[model samples]
Target: MNLLHAYVSGRVQGVYFRGWTRGHAQRLGLHGWVRNLRDGRVEVLASGPDNALRELQELLYEGPALSRVDGVEIVAMADEEQPTHGFSIAPTV
Candidate 1:
């Protein structure tokens, strides 16, 4: 299993980015959440098989057609409590 923390920048807010993320994550069978941060970036944390996680990261770059994803910053989240079911859209933080 792998855990990943990602921050997607550039016009991520008000674009249904969180919903878009959840759809892809769930499709990949990842258990995690995506939410809008106060700073305008979309935050994503997910845990699943390594391959699925990698695929998610790539899909994030494409996002929804209405979005303009400028960058995706990835970080390794170790020893964190990850979700155990389907992906979800979390409240903004």
Candidate 2:
């Protein structure tokens, strides 16, 4: 398994980014959550098979049709920090 912690920047807020992230995460059988940051970025944390996580990372770059994703900064997380189950869209923080 692999865990990914990412911050997606650029025109990501107010564009259904969280919703689209949750949907894609769930479809990929990833566990964790996505939320909007006060700094106009979108934050995502997901854990799953390495292949699945890689696929999801690709999708994050494109996001929804309305979003203009400038960049995605991703980091690998230790297994202890990875969420165990389910994907969700979290409240803005």
Q: Give the Cα lDDT of each candidate.
A: 0.90, 0.92
lDDT of 1 by residue, 1-93 (tens): 778899999998988889888988888889989999999999999999999999999998998988999999998666558778888888889
Model 2 TM-score is 0.95
Residue pairs whose backbone atoms clash in candidate 2: none
Quote each prediction's TM-score.
0.93, 0.95
Q: List ranges where model 1 is wrong by over 4 Å.
A: none
Task: Give the Cα-based TM-score of candidate 1 against the true structure.
Answer: 0.93
Name the 10 consecutive residues with the lowest summed lDDT in model 1: 75-84
lDDT of the structure predicted as candidate 1: 0.90
